[model samples]
Target chain A: MCVLAEEGYTGTADVKAFLAEHHGLALSDVDGHLYHHLNEEAIRHLFRVSSSLDSMVLGEPQILGQVKDAYGYASEFKSIGAVLDKFFSKAFSVAKRVRTETKVASSAVSISYAGVELARKIFGDLKDKTVMLIGAGEMCELAARHLLNAGVKGIMVTNRTYERAVKLAEEFDGTAIRFEEMVSHLKTADIVISSTGSPHFILKRDDVEEVIRIRRNRPMFFVDMAVPRDIDPDINDIDNVYVYDIDDLNNVIETNLEERQKEAGRAEEIVVTEVAAFRRWLDAQQVTPTIVSLRRKFDEIREAEVAKAMSMLGTDDPKTRKVVEALASSILNKVLHAPVTALKNDGNGRDPMELVAVVRELFDLTDGGKDCE
Target chain B: MQTLLLKSTTATYLVGALLYLYFIVTLKERGARLGRMFLLIGVVMHLFGFGMRFAEAGHTPITNLFESLSFFALVIVGAFLATELRYNLRVLGAFVAPLAFLFSLLSAFQKSELQSLNPALNSSWLPVHVIVLFIAYAFFAVQFAAGIMYLMQERQLKGKHLGAIFKRLPSLDVLDDINYRCLTIGFPLLTIGIITGSVWAQDAWGTYWSWDPKETASLATWLVYAALLHGRLTVGWRGRKAAIVAIVGFLLVVFTFLGINLLPAGKHTYASIAR
Candidate 1:
């Protein structure tokens, strides 16, 4: 819904008309749908979007990475010119600054992610670890999906209903164990996510202790998402086994969400400062072409006057001509210095385009017959 | 010149160790790279120093405590670099560099003067037996550091701390893998070291076995590693149990390598008793 278009106000009408024609809509209808903002506002909007300040989830990390990927594609396709390249790169840095300067993305906000975070803290790398699911509950499937995305090597699904277990295992490309055999196959799993309809604990401390011994004390993480708590609390006392029930994981997510809410306020302040800074850079960018043209104009006048003077003085000596040429350049630079300073300093307070227009008029810069910028 | 090179090596190692510690705390790649550079420089200088010491002493230069400790430090750094190159375990430098620095600092305090070779250590077997055993000890040192890291990480996981230290430390499996790797490498070298040592004993003392403190302690250390290797290969003994055993085995290695000299009990006590 957001579009970052470069150049000044002259291109806005053309963009609106182009959008209307492409989508086969009326001009008034397209104009109503297209809410346009100028350079500074567009930059602010992009910064907010990339920083996830505008997201429904205030500080989710995925939006920033998605923005980066979009920018990378634009770069690879060479669709963006210099201005948008500078703009998006600045937006990326602003997002990064917001991330690092605040605790926004540091905490887990979702329940499934909370489980994944805890698993990482225990197992570090989950790529080669297996997960075992005791039931086919939606919550357990969600958590397993998060773990799968986190690179868990495989998944094993089991249910009292053999057909249901097979269907769920096929969904995950994993094995299906009979509910009776799940405990026997538990030794192969590094993480056990259990959420069955059973009313009592399916696994106990003694069972896990025996499994840990058979596995020679490799660590195991168990997430009990069942309401009745499929894993026993006593199993947490085992040396390398960690058991977290739904309430425990919920507590983790709650604390993390509270932390993120506080950090979101700080992230907003960073976005505001960065938006203002980027606006200043954009303002400076407006004057660069003017400054280049102004410098070129001064150099042309300096060369013409220097040539005229050297011919009148009839200086055949190369040393005298070099000195005169150096003097001309020095004086031209001195003369151009004040106006150039005035143009660049416009970003601090005054409107930069006002100064740019004034310089262009005073120097007759547009007399070179460049129609539009 | 060798003494100067060795002193500079010590200073460089301290710098490298501090940089590696900084890298661990900050998780900065540049600090790790700079630390590796300094470690490389120290190893080269230490090698040159060893060559010069051998030339000046007219022997392998490990006949005394100073030379033995210095050489042990060098091999530890060398082994660490090789492991780091193979594993890309930059965070491990935080554990290893400081130990190398401590060893070099300890060697710096010892008498650096060339000592007359003990008559029993005068043969060519001196370098073969001592260097092989010291190399095994070097691998064990790396394993010990990994074991300590493993224990720290495992405690954090069991306790569910998940704090900054837990985040910085490597996983249990990776640390356990390093422990197994070091044990597999160190145990066989240890077996070979024992064999070569007994051969040297037969040539020098007219016996294939000696009940001297150093010889007995070395045998005990070798047996500990052998048992650990057996447990790992046969029963899949790993993680906390393996880390604990690795740590205990390194302690025994330390005792055999240096602590045995303090007891004043054997011909291997060349630096403490003979000197």
Candidate 2:
């Protein structure tokens, strides 16, 4: 969770105290962690988060889209100013560079996604196929969600606890079937993702053979995400029926993990180069105000001298006064040129702030005593 | 002019078959589209040539082997186009278009000179029996192609080898559906063709049933499909089992139509019937 706020504003501390007072929980009570990233660190951290290099599943593609949505909402509410706006847009481009230059997000690294990929190979299109979840485990629900996103027609969830089944069904807007009648419902299922705690096989070869007959031998895919295995391995032998246990999914995920590790190293290199480029932009931004003030001070003195010469010469001719004013302005710009150029050219391996301070001091551009440091 | 058209039809079919085969190997949709376009053009040229031949022969041009084979190729490609339009089975062209090209090539090699119709085949039922039976064979040919695809995909699934071919083939369910669809249509046409042929036999030879090699072979093919259709409707025999039966039945259809014609024991031989 990144917070884009004004300088010197300690919103993180305020949020921690608010949580303690309102929720009766200390900041550390929930194993909560926070990091405050200042100007340069903030840019680098945002690049990592949006690129998904810092995620639990490295190179997952969803984080960049989520960050884009959050940026959209913050912009709509006018929460961010010019600095944050530029920072976020730069971060988005950096994330895109990481994605295309590295092979990080090219494969399915999660069990649920792997199941979806396998199901597509069997079923062609899942739009008209039904998925049945035999238990209410988190893995089962997650696999169901992935199948739903893949466009399965409907979901049927059955758990040992009827209420749990009903709760999960409502979450997916699916039907809740009785656990005992789950076998009868198997005929309608094209894909079954089962993760039950039963000590034995919930779906055996004979049970699936009967169901396949009822289905008129339409292909059925079974994803068994259980420890002891809720679906029997022999079920795979039945024609038009497939069973993929947790180990198969783990094998796929492990291979993808190995591939992603190699790509992650490449992605980190991209982040480093991008952070350096953004740092140069930040250095330029830092000296802009000093340059603006220095020019303004020189113009002020030039204007005073021009008005004094015009009044003392008592020149009533408008053309003569214009010529004097133009000369004074030209001299002011010529004197300010070299210092201003040095301040703006920040990528030369020189400190821009030191240059800004010297220019300010030489011209006495700072307030009398307030901003002397 | 008709000979030129027939020769062009053969060339077009060859090109189309090659394009579809390329589509299969490359997994490219553009090749399939171009193949379909060539097939459509070939079918048009084939129909035009058949019409001109009918005018020249003063009867249905299916009186000889060359005409029959060419007509058979036309219907097979026609049936495939209809199936593709209905099912979007684009990849099937790779399997099916080559069969059409083979038949057309065989037709092109035969004696294509126009000959007078046989006096025995002068009755109106000649067209009804032969055309109906050829259409059935065409549909059966399509079912055979789909069955092969089903078997290939089922092997990929059963063997757990999800390679490039697996991705190119249609799902088991869709291929099975095509099999059943072709069976339901082909079986009835085949039944009608057999009944009409027996009726025409009664009028032409004073016998409703004779054990001519062609007649016996067609009956055997009929029985194979009848059992397949019955098994599918009743016991729900589908997927690998159904695909195997459909393939075997089509092989029998091929033998009844082509192989039996080569045997001298049949009165329905191209030499005996046409001369």
**Highest TM-score among the candidates is held by which one?**
1
- lDDT (tens digit, per residue) of candidate 2 on B1-275: 89789768989999999999999987667899999999999999999998997888888889877888889999999999999999998899999999999988888888888877789988899889999999999999999999999888877766654555766887777888899999988999999999999999999999999999988998999999999988888887887888899999999988888888667766787533233
Tens digits of lDDT, candidate 2, A1-373? 5566644344567756765667777768733565677776777789999999999999898899999999999999987655567678888988898887777886678888988877876777789989999987888888899999999999999999999999999999999999999999999998999988999998888888888887877789999998898999989998878888988778767877787898899999988888887676555445776777777777788889999999998977999999998999888788877777787785245444445545666877654323111
- Regions of candidate 1 where Cα sits further than 4 Å from its true position: A1-45, A53-59, A65-86, A96-109, A117-128, A216-218, A247-277, A285-373, B273-275
Candidate 1 residue lDDT tens string, A1-373: 4555556423778888888898899899988777776766787788888989888777888888888888888889876656577678888888889888877777677778888988886777899999998997878899999999999999999999999999999999999999999889999999999888888889988899999988878889999988877889889888778888887777776766677788888987887877777665445446888898888888888889989988999877888889999999888889888888888787345556656656776887763323112
Q: Provide the clash count, candidate 2.
A: 0
Q: Report clash pairs, candidate 2.
A: none
Model 2: residues with Cα > 4 Å off, grouped in runs: A1-109, A120-129, A151-154, A175-181, A184-188, A214-219, A250-373, B271-275
Measured against the true two-chain complex, the DockQ scores of the candidates, in the order shown, are 0.30, 0.30
Docking quality of model 2: it rates as acceptable
lDDT of 2 at A113: 91
In model 2, the Cα lDDT at residue B210 comes to 92
Per-model B-chain TM-score: 0.97, 0.97
- Give the winner by lDDT: 2
Instruction: Compose the digit string of candidate 1's lDDT tens values, residues B1-275.
Output: 89888867889999999999999987777899999999999999999999998899889988777777788889999989988987788888999889989888888888887778778788988888888888899999999999999888877666654556665787677788899999988988898889988998899889999799988998889888988999888887888788899999999998887788889568777866233
